[model samples]
Target: MTLQNQSGTSTIRPTIDTMDLEEIVELRTSHMVVGGAALARDANGRVVFVSGALPDELVMVRMVTAKKDFATAEVVSVTEPSASRVEPACEAWHRGCGGCDWQHIAPAAQVAMKTDMVREALSRTARVDQPVVVTGAAIAPWGYRTTVRLAVGDDGRVGFRSRRSHDVVALRACPVADERINGLLATVVAAGTDELSLRVGVAGAELIAWGAPGALVSGLADTVRIGATAVVHEDVAGHRFRVSATSFFQSSPEAAELLVAAVTRAAAGLDLGQCTVIDAYGGVGLFAATVARGAERVVLVEASASACADARHNLRGQRAEVMEMRLEAWTPIAADLVIADPARNGLDKSAAARLVQTGASRIVLVSCDAGSLARDTRLLREHGYAHRGTEVLDVFPNTSHVETVTRFDRFAPGDRANHPDHV
Candidate 1:
């Protein structure tokens, strides 16, 4: 069958009775897209997003999802491979482990692809023409994840849920997680819980796990701690943060440090010493205790009560306020600068509008999703804020998740001194 590809060239595809009858199709991929998929076109000229594939590679994929305009597939076989492709560190990845999507790509190439994704999102979605240069930070490819959430299968297997489905992929060892975490993977399989969260801190020596309050973890190591109220203290950017079982931290201390550095650089010009900073969605006081610690008053707004409890303890001695409420509903307070590290969904219009109501002179947005970052920045722009710049950190190695720290300045006539939007 002849098909029109993204290159606008005629290509031959396998002629099948129907996608229902023959789920597999051969296609050559074009460029990398968000969510660790490569863009391609199938026989019917419908856009095909293929996972477990790389840019400019010809691969046979099995279609799992079908829509009128697009389809999603997972690579079945690679007829032609790219040089950047490498063996995944974790053997479980080949078994459909959903932890790391880009484990097949070389580390350096992964960083480049993340940068490309961020730049394309800003340019295409946000319509920003100001360079949109994304800075990619290098990180270790394996054995760096300090925190992991394991799903328990009905057959008493422990591992991660497969992408596009809830089916768990049982694993013998997880190479991407910290070595200590891998040590406990087997012990937690029989913990009598459907879900488990594991974490290691204190230079990878302290191990903490959380499951049901009365989990059967007697088989776990003596050094390992587990319970519903369990918490881990992580040291990042020269400050120790108490992270509760419910609070979210970076995958590793190194990832947290890189993010802190990038955010500090994005807010470099602000006089933090005299400014009042608002750490929106501040989990466990990461920014309140590090990047914005120098500010006169730091307000950390988070909806998680458990996280707020940890933040209260972590932000000790600093002039900080812990408000346990969603940022979208929090009353706008006076703050010179706002550092919003929103979750994957990014800042919605209501939240963005509320954030702008703070009358903050500068806004630094830390986003983990490229598309959401683009939409949020565009919303802020519509609220009379000029996009200053964006810096991306590829801390989550071997994954398509891109961490972006963006800066914006409020714009208004006759407010050159307070709001330097022109600068």
Candidate 2:
């Protein structure tokens, strides 16, 4: 079957009978695929990929491309909804801004799905049978995001890209944005001339608007500082943080507090008090200072020189040694605990292997991307570390991204004999 769009583009449509007969398979082992939602297999037994559908959803899909080994389809309908499915909160999500995913799933279900994805990635990719627990977010799902970037449309209106395409999607307001940002958006949109992009930051219900040329517009109260440390806010974890427009800090203060607490708790069981500790990818030293409270000596490894300078200011009085070097080049000293909160890429193979080689008694990995976490965890397990446990933190709500804290203990072949069921 074939369906044509208004633009005269043709798409192959899958038969309803075939969709109804296809077996249910889990996408990324998190989302279930059923009915027309599942891609049809050719006579050669190669599976196809379907979009805009969820698990248990009976969709009548239109195949857009069919290669020799695989195919791609677009969903037409869903006869049944997955138990986890829910109405998407953001109407602009389907337009493909690349900002949020999993908006159609319930918040609780999203967390659970992320937890399962982490566990499966560990077991299959890392070959560890470790148990995982999911945790709730620190703040409300909607209106919790404090920062957002929007592309300026050709029509002089700021908008976001469509869900899966570069085409701009017109948006009057963003639901996930804080009310303060929305208010600022109104003013910006009203006074717009031809700005290519707009970046807004919200702090405690006050909005600070920055134009494409990096000039402040309005809605800021005053610059808050702690001693020489100057930021939009002074208080973070009972200490002052020197934050700026470019400096990386967690947008949600509430969520940041919860995440910091979780990381602190995860490190409590490990004896970092007397041993040297390395906080790799330590941005602004938020976690470094928190973890340093317990560690006798802490070494923060960062690649960004500017962030390291900020770290120096943030950790002025704290007993921490800052090393401005990449994680790959920096030599690893044996430590009690190593906390790594890397970017979305997680840890490269070299860094992951190096951490294992350091022989750190315990490793706490904080990741925003589950797939990368799973891949790194598997790498660690292969290098003689036993997965202790994993906890999912819903840092970014109303979106598919999840923060996870995974603990690992260095293991020897005969060590498990003393402690059975360790893995």
Among these predictions, the greatest lDDT belongs to 1
In angstroms, give how far residue 274 of model 2 lies from its true place. Answer: 1.5
In model 1, the runs with Cα more than 4 Å from the true position are 1-21, 413-423
Worst 10 residues of 2 by lDDT: 27-36
Per residue, candidate 1 scores C-alpha lDDT tens digits across 1-423 of 567643467876554325562467678898887777998887656788989899999897888777777888888888889999988867777777887888899988887888788888887788887535677586797888888888878876679998657899987678888888888886665557887778888553678887766656544787787765777778888898887777899988889999899888888888899999999999899988999988999999999999999999999999999999998789989889999999999999889988999999889999999899889978998887877778878888888988888888887866665342333
Local error of candidate 2 at 183, Å? 1.7
lDDT of all the models against the reference?
0.83, 0.63
CA-only RMSD, every prediction: 3.2, 6.8
lDDT of 2 by residue, 1-423 (tens): 565522245755343335433433222111422211233443235565666565445455555655566666665555556777777767667556556655766766666555665666666566665555555454677886666666656654566666567776766667777676565555454124233233233333233434444332333334411111223443557766665544566756666777788777777766666777778888879888776666778889888776788889888776898888888988888777888989988999888876766678788888887678777877776676666777877777766566888777777677865232453
Task: Provide the lDDT at 115 for model 2.
Answer: 65
Over 4 Å off in model 2, which ranges?
A: 1-50, 64-74, 94-98, 133-138, 189-206, 209-231, 234-236, 416-423
What are the TM-scores, per candidate, against the unseen true structure? 0.91, 0.78
